[model samples]
Target: MSDDGVRWLDEDQQHHWRALVMGTTLLFDRLDNDLSREHGISLAEYEILVRLSEREGRRMRMAQLADSMAHSRSRVTHTVGRLEKSGLVERIKSPEDGRGVVCAMTEQGWELLVAMAPTHVRGVRDNLVDLADPADFAAVGRVFDAVADHLVAAHPEMEIRGH
Candidate 1:
């Protein structure tokens, strides 16, 4: 700790931290651009589609979807609205309860997802996965898992496990 009681990162730590930031920014931009150019979808929208596909019946409640993605409800709503406009997804009243809304993937959405899966996976592998040794990539996963767990612990409402 310094005299003012601040515990700043050391030189190596600073270097690594900056690298993480820059790497993530560039990697995400590249992935987003690839998807946009080839498939005409943004990475964020693709992530929503992927999440919905992983759920039972290819649907999830709006609130659950937002929580699962660590996004705000309004943001999810807006994105889903755009998807609905494109005929990719539909928002319906939740069957479990008549109150909440559920976002369901349409057949068109499923087909598009199927078609774009390869492009997305290739982009991921080309940009990130294949760049690191298996053990080093596994370590990166572990580090992010710990970071997510710690952050979510402090905000229990944002926790998405088992949802």
Candidate 2:
């Protein structure tokens, strides 16, 4: 412990922390830029689309989508609004809960995803997957999974879901 009674990271911890931060920043930026340049959509938009596609009837509640994406509800609303304007998604009343809103992928959106999937997969492989050992990637996934679980447990109201 230091004078402040703080337990600082040891050398190995410092190295891993720095690597994780830098790697995540560079990797996400690269993926976002690549998606924007090639598909006219940001990585965030692509994630929304993927989440919608994964759901039954290609739709999910706005709040649920926001949670799944680890984005704020307002941010998801804005992003969805942009997607709605682009004819990629539609906002509709939730059938289960009339007052709630649901976001559904449009046919055009599905088509767009189909067209862009290959490029996005290739970009992912090029930027991340191909660079890491399979075991290391699996370990990374487990690490984040545990982190998410801990955080959600600590703050249940601020729910976070894996996409």
Candidate 3:
């Protein structure tokens, strides 16, 4: 503890922390920009589509989608609204429940996702994956898994795991 009675990062810890922050920021920006430039869709929108595609029927309740993405319902709704306008996805009353709405990807959305997946994957490879050794990349995954586990345990009500 320092004079202020607060534990602080040492010089090496500070360096690594800053690198993590900057690297993630730049990496996400680059990935988002790549998707936006080539596919006319933001990374967030693409991610929503991906989540739906992986579901049993390519559909998910709006609330579940929001929870899976760790985004607010309103934010997800707003993005879905834009996607709906673009004819990429549709919102309908859930079949199991008349009250909850479900977001389903349209055929057009699936086609778009199939086409643009390569671009996103290439960006990830070029920007990050290929830059690291295999072992180091695996270590990164382990680090994040630990971080995610800690955070999820700290906030069990968030229900942000296992989509």
Best by lDDT: 3
Prediction 1 TM-score vs. true: 0.94
On TM-score, who's better, 1 or 2?
1
Question: Candidate 1 residues 131-153, lDDT tens each?
Answer: 99999999998797778777776
Q: Of the candidates shown, which would achieve the greatest TM-score relative to the real structure?
A: 1
lDDT string for model 2 (45-138, tens) is 9999998888789999999898877789999999999999999999999998699999999999999989888878988899888899999889
**Model 2 alpha-carbon miss at residue 129, Å:** 1.4
At residue 43, what lDDT does model 3 achieve?
A: 96
Q: Once superposed on the true structure, which residue ranges of model 3 sit more than 4 Å away at CA?
A: 154-163
lDDT of 3 at 11: 97
Q: What is the lDDT of candidate 3?
A: 0.90
**What overall lDDT goes with each candidate model?**
0.89, 0.88, 0.90
Q: After superposition, how far is residue 133 of candidate 3 from its true place, in Å?
A: 0.9
> TM-score of predicted model 3?
0.92
Better of 1 and 3 by lDDT: 3
